[model samples]
Target: MKNYLRLLTHVLLISWCACNPCTRVESVDISAGVLLENGSVIYDGLEYPKSTWYEELADELVKRYGCPCIGRVCMWKCCGPGQTPFNGSCLDTGLAEVNPFNPPVYRGREPSNITAYGTFFYMHGHPCIDSYLVDTADVNEELFIQENGTLMEVAIGGTQWHLPTGYCVDMKYHNNSVAPRLVAAVCFPEENVSTDDSPLLYIAYAVGLLLSVPFLLATFLVYAMIPELRNLHGMCLMAYCAGLIVAFPFLAYLKLHVGRIGVAMTGCLVVAFIVYYAFQTSFFWLNVMCFDIWRTFSGYRGGSTNKRRDNKRFCLYAIYAWGVPAILTACTAGMQFSDNLPSHIVVPGFGSRRCWFVNWLSEFVYFFTPVLFLVVSNVIFFSVTAHRIRSIRQETAILKGAESSRSDKLKKDKQRYALYLKLFMVMGVNWTVELISFAVGGSNWYWIVVDISNIALGVVIFFIFVWKKKVRGLVQKRFRHMLGMPPVATDSRTGRWTTSSAPTEDTRISADETAIRLKDMH
Candidate 1:
């Protein structure tokens, strides 16, 4: 009885399985259109069977194919033979088909009675309009050739053509015969013709930038090697110098090699990014110095005595100096790569057009704005600090018995302030000139001279910070200590150099103590 029941149960299960077979989902190639899982069809890369409105279709066509809709049909922007689409228009390859006997003619117009015909090809050396036919005579002066060789009509007597003077016209043979058929038109500007700096100027600029690297490196080395110069101020200077050291070489490299490498290359993008980040960090570090000096003079008690406290303060400075620029750079990178952003929104455009900001507007918005803010803040800080210094000098001048000591302290303060002032002038003036030169829009000799002078910023920094009597003494002491020689003695009270006849062992001070003393003196 149990066996009969088991067999009956198996038969019922088989019947149920036969009644409900599984359905497998498989990908099928559709000839008419691509079918989505949601039952939407993509016909010719556009949504199909959804909108019949011409306006809607036009928008879809523009979004999907970047082509215009004409007469209720999508008119694709086609590149001619030996031409490739770039940016928005066709870029001519050197191998463009040329037929002097058969010139471009207006579409839908007879060849003999055509008002517009090619007088000569305008060869501007630009890929977009190279070998494009120049319109000598047009019945309607408003009619001009576009960059893709299409005939376009503008407003009567409009000056828009002056903006991008060059125009392109692509030709096709009618019925495979010698008769030419004009297909498309393109218009591009000659703005870059006079804007390009002379090759000699570029070479000089690159050379100037390269020349500063060694001086900047030397400045960094001096700060890094000397234990006494490893304080917050010295460390800031070192960081600033290091930023310039990295930036200058890369900038020079870009100036020299960007043309050969091409803006689209990965290496060009990487180098451009490095240069941007380095310069930004340098600016931030310089701001840090200015703020630090101001804080010191404002009677701020933090980061003064304790080593731990100083380190903590420096960590905070590093975070601000490095972190802000990192965030900015990341934002730039994101914008450069993002496709979701609207056309109106400005993007960094790095590596797309060139290895820098795409246009002056983007450059000003992304780079110059932040730099300007920092510079303004620095100016305010310096102003306040200067006022404070004057007040302190007046107060100290009232002391008669300790006049010499007070004078010496005031002199030291002035010297320190002077160093920062010189540094500020070096960077500030250089950038100011750069902004002016960029705005001027041409290779003016006066600005070129200023640019050459700006290139010596590293040398200026070296002289201002490292070529001093005090620094020389510190360098000498550091070298002696490294060589295991007798260290120089200084008067403890006045902190001035002194000759000592004492034995090296008895007169020797710990490096830490010397560093601390140097820190206190500053």
Candidate 2:
């Protein structure tokens, strides 16, 4: 039922995206006078085009949305207090009024086309526009002259384009007007990103992190309380997942709110370090699980009988994986914190801002390292499956001409397959959650995605274990007896296997014989 509901939800979201087209407005940041439309915040103020044609706009949209990439669908982050969708309203948590954003449509450098998009630093929903498009224009250099700002004029046969700092204009597709692509990005300084107020991205991250707690607690309980899971390799991986959940909240909080909360300035990065390594550890644990399955199922459990997992090695590796990312991030942060990164590397919509990945470089590596691991691990999963099939064939051959009972093999195959199923389910959930939110046009999407994925994974063990037919049948029988129902014939209406009318001793002996024969034959 849960799977069916998720499938249905995904289909509905895809259909909705097909039906709704986004609206865009020419939003001007008076402080920068940069134009935002499509996804690019036009940064080359001197290069603003006079006319916007379909071809130019199409190209920009593709780049802005990072289209053709089939992974996660993230939002076009805005300079708002809460990582609000990019409709241009800015929300400031504690600072004075936020950046000014005014939507624009041009009446030819005329003052008539400029409309205030919004000024207050509070979220007011996404702006209604697919971004902006403009046609041929002119530049009144004197129109927005302020020290370094200048306007330029360019010609394309009969038309001229003008760009003014504070002026507004609109353009549409015209066969006669064509211009090269203009792109830029929206960004705050690295200092601001690590500031005490915690910008929108950090806040968005914080919310997602904070919600990870329950899953983390659930995970610890799975290991700490459940005796069956204590040494089981699969459960160990689940434990790692639990560990990842715990780290997400802590790392994100440090990255997002540590400074704001008046914690140690350096502690932010330290927590971030732990977070990075923790994720790597989790991914590595997942890889270990695949290997364990291949080894155990293939009956190649060759390790010495008394040998157990090395707690010391586990701790050391965890430190190294995390320490490496921290060191990498720290070096990068030093460069970034010192106004490093190449200037020629320009990202559209960023305008003139000159940093990338910001201060939470650790977080980026933390989140994204899994993608690489996921790909490689998935390949290993298939390889392991293929190898197991080959082993089964060989083992059956060794038994030469004897009819090999396949039930045991089939059961093992299922256990192997379940791991694959769980990983695929997790990925699918992330994609569906992300894709739907993108179509619906909201940045609150991340919060929902993170929370749902964590909770769902923790709950999966229950359904997969408790809902299987044989397992559930036993549970039902026990429950029926507990409820004072006399053991009688099988409940045919519910199709439950009925207990025999024989005595308990006879039943026990029969069960033991069946078990022995089944084991020999299997």
Against the hidden true structure, what lDDT does model 2 obtain? Answer: 0.39
lDDT of 1 at 31: 32
Tens-place lDDT digits, model 1, residues 1-522 = 797667556656644654311111111122356556664556555453322111111222211111112112211224544554344465654433432322333442323333222332232223342222222232222344433334453322222332122333444332333433343332322222556556677677789999998999999999889766776778888889988999998888766753344444688778878888899999999899899888877982222244556678999999999899999999878876665454457777665445666566778778887888888888898999999888776666664245654455456666677789878877876786677666776655558667776788898888888887777877877787788777776676987866454733223344674233334224
Tens digit per residue, CA lDDT, model 2, 53-88 = 111123222112111111211122234433222223
Clash count in backbone of candidate 1: 16
Question: How does candidate 2 fare on TM-score?
Answer: 0.40
lDDT (Cα) of model 1: 0.60
Model 1 poorest ten-residue lDDT run: 20-29
On a 0 to 1 TM-score scale, where does candidate 1 land against the true structure?
0.64
